[model samples]
Target: MAGPLTSLKVLDFSTLLPGPYATMMLADMGAEVLRVEAPDRVDLTKVMPPFDGKISTAFSYLTRSKRTLALNLKQAEAVDKVKELVRDYDIVVEQFRPGVMDRLGIGYETLKAINPRLIYCAITGYGQTGPYRDRAGHDINYLSIAGVSSHCGRADSGPPPLGIQVADVAGGSHHAVMGILAAVIERQQTGAGQFVDISMTDAAFALNAMAGAASLAGGQEQQPESALLNGGSFYDYYQTRDQRWLSIGSLEPQFSARLCDTLGLSELKSLALSQKPEDQQRLKTALKDKVAEKTLVEWQEIFADQDACVEPVLTITEAAEHPQLKARGMVIEVDRGDGVMQRQIGNPIIFGVKT
Candidate 1:
């Protein structure tokens, strides 16, 4: 039995999270992905920390099920090899800044000329055309420019730096996968390949839909932590007695009522949607005082059978072992050769049609 993309062939010249992640998804779906690495510039993740003596855990996890092809694209012979290889591969993914690949003689136009059916994808920070295309940027810069960091943090404090690379993975990686797959479908009908230009910042801008509706469409900027989902309502996280945190997302009237009743704060339920600063503070303070009265474990026990959407905020290790996550098989053990098994995050999508 084979996965959905078993017959697809992908030649990946991308490194790091965004491009690698896109091709990794294809590889996981059973595509034959060949990671094309420059002879002089190996992927930095190959030497990143948390290693198994010599092998990098990060690189191992990302490059799994994919073959590697080292080539010096700077040389004419190497560029010719790539042009030849593109004729056989169905897809090509690259993550260089604008013009880098074009200078290498293996740009989209050159490859498409060789292989008309090749789906070429280019992932960059700003994109290939704009004024900032040549500018250097990472996830933080992309998020900041994309307007995602504007309403990210607390109202009192400035935007707290994100723990994850939202722009890299959510914006670039996910969108690259989407654009490539859409191109794949289109190619089936037209029998022609196309270029997929992915900009991290551009992709991240779409994630501002909720806040964008209020700001862009309504002509009023949403203040940080002043919106329903941004911590304006009574739905937020509170500190427990043991210093652990508990998240409460009882947004609906029924759920709010349940939470209020469970906490013996029935009088405050009516103020759930209050926009008044004082009322919001009073309700938040009351809930905080109540939550701080018990440990996270105690709160978890109290809400175990409740529909209040109240749950303890567990650490990464705790989350990995959590009952719900374990039951759903979100964490899986992958054998990394020589009987060495490492726990990796499982794929979320469950296809109905098994190969």
Candidate 2:
């Protein structure tokens, strides 16, 4: 079956997580993606562990459904070959330091001259033009700069989040993909392509929209785990008797009351009163005692029939093997050219066509 993006072609000159992940998403949707890898630069995913001994499981997941071209752009022949490829490709995605592409003579300006209809997306830590554009940074630094890290962990701890790669995946990869798709749509109308400069820091800033609004309205910069969504007893994670955790999302008073009723804590239902400072603390204490009374399985069964929005906190492995995930095909096994197969998170979109 033909995929939604079967007609599109992408030349991906990106290494590591963000760019590769974005291109991989497009490739999963049947976009003809040509990943340009350097012959000398070892694929970092291959260097890291959790491999299948012969091939990197991480690399296999990200590079699937795409053709790999081991090209060293420093070579004169490679440059000419890339130029020729640029003429036919619909989009070119490069995630390099600010000046690296220009130094290699494959910058957006040069590529756009060759193919004015090309959608060129450049992803970087900062951006192509900024005071700190040349500064090197990773996901942590970008999140810190965007104030995303400040709202991450527990109120008493200064530690950062470990689960979400907000800057790389959410900020960089998703932002670049959105920009490229928008550019593609705009190109159809204007018959001309444009440069999409995606700054990881700027993309991360998008996540701080709510916090920024709160700050603008004279609210203090709340502690990480003390915010309404983060700390409120009715809205956060709670540990049960079995040591497993369950998440409570009773943000509304009615839902919180329903949750309290389900847990047989009618007296604690009053804890779900207005979100005032004192009331929030009372709710936290009440929820702590109430949730501790049951195992995670018990709580799951208790809230199963209710719309109190409660769910067990699943580990990564458990989440991957979840029934809903299995039914939706969210976890798929892909061949990595070796004898072994690699498990990967599947594309979330359900397209009418397939490739």
Candidate 3:
């Protein structure tokens, strides 16, 4: 049985995280993805540590279910070959800086001329137009430019380095997938393809979500730890006796009451709903002290039966082996096409069974 995107074909020229990630999702959904890589281009993922049978572990998962082609676009013959592939591959994803693709003679307009139904998606840090269009940037630079990092960390400490690439994955890669799919849908109505410009900074700015809405419409600018959800209230992480972290999100009155009861600090329930700075500080202090009294496992056991939104922070390895994630089939084994099966993170999308 074919997957949902069985009819789609993708030609990916992007290296590293963003574009590869987008195409990976497409391949996971049954789209045939082919990578057109330069013969000498150095992709860090290919050489990164922890190799599984010569290739790096990350490259194995990112390139799962996708075929590869080495071609140097500097050669006219190679460019012609890509143009030939454009006639068959309707979707093209690239991460080159602005004008680089045009200089290579394989830009969106060039390909669209050959195939009017080509959905060309360009993923960049600052987009196709703007002052920083050609600027070099990474995940943190985009987040900082987009103001996402402004309110993420503690006020005193400033923005701490995040463990994950929020702008690359959440902004660039995710938006490219969405834009390509949307163009595919619109093509059905208009019988034409369109250029999808996905800027990591632009998408990161959009990620402000509730905070952006409030600031744009209500004239309320949120600073670090100034918002209710960003550690302004008692709904934050607490350190346990064993130095492990536990996230507490008992915002609702019911959950707050339950949390306080579970901690034997039911008297602090009134302070939970109060937005007063002093009240919030008081509640936070109480939670910190109580949480420090026991280890993470001890608190997990005590709150196992409670409905309070309290959960211990588990390491990535612990999360992989957890019963809930195991039950959800979040861990899957991908065939490496060499009789060897490689374990990789499974796609999160759940689709209805085909009748």
Question: Sorted by lDDT, highest first, which candidate order results?
Answer: 3, 1, 2
Q: Write the per-residue lDDT of candidate 2 for residues 1-355, one digit (tens) a residue.
A: 1488898999999988999999998988889999999999987976776777667777888888889999999988988899999999999999888878888888888998999999999999998898989999989999999887777677677756566688899999999999999998999899999999999999998878777788768677756766777663457888999998988888788888888888777787776776577877777778888889989888888888899888999988999988888888898887777656778889998966543
Q: Candidate 2 — which residues are off by over 4 angstroms?
A: 217-220, 352-355
Clashing pairs in 1: none
Preferred candidate (lDDT higher): 1 or 2: 1
Predicted structure with the largest lDDT when compared to the true one: 3
Off-target runs (Cα >4 Å) in candidate 3 are 336-338, 353-355
**Structure candidate 2, residue pairs in collision:** 1-354
Ranking by TM-score: 3, 1, 2
lDDT score for residue 254 of model 1: 91
The local distance difference test score of each candidate is 0.89, 0.86, 0.92
Candidate 2 lDDT score at position 11: 99
Error of 2 at 287 (Å): 1.4
State the local distance difference test value for candidate 2: 0.86
After superposition, which runs of candidate 1 have C-alpha atoms over 4 Å from their true positions?
337-339, 353-355
Greater TM-score among 2 and 3 belongs to 3
lDDT (C-alpha) at residue 106 in model 1: 93
In candidate 1, what are the lDDT values of residues 277-316, reduced to their tens digit? 6787789899999999999999999999999889888888
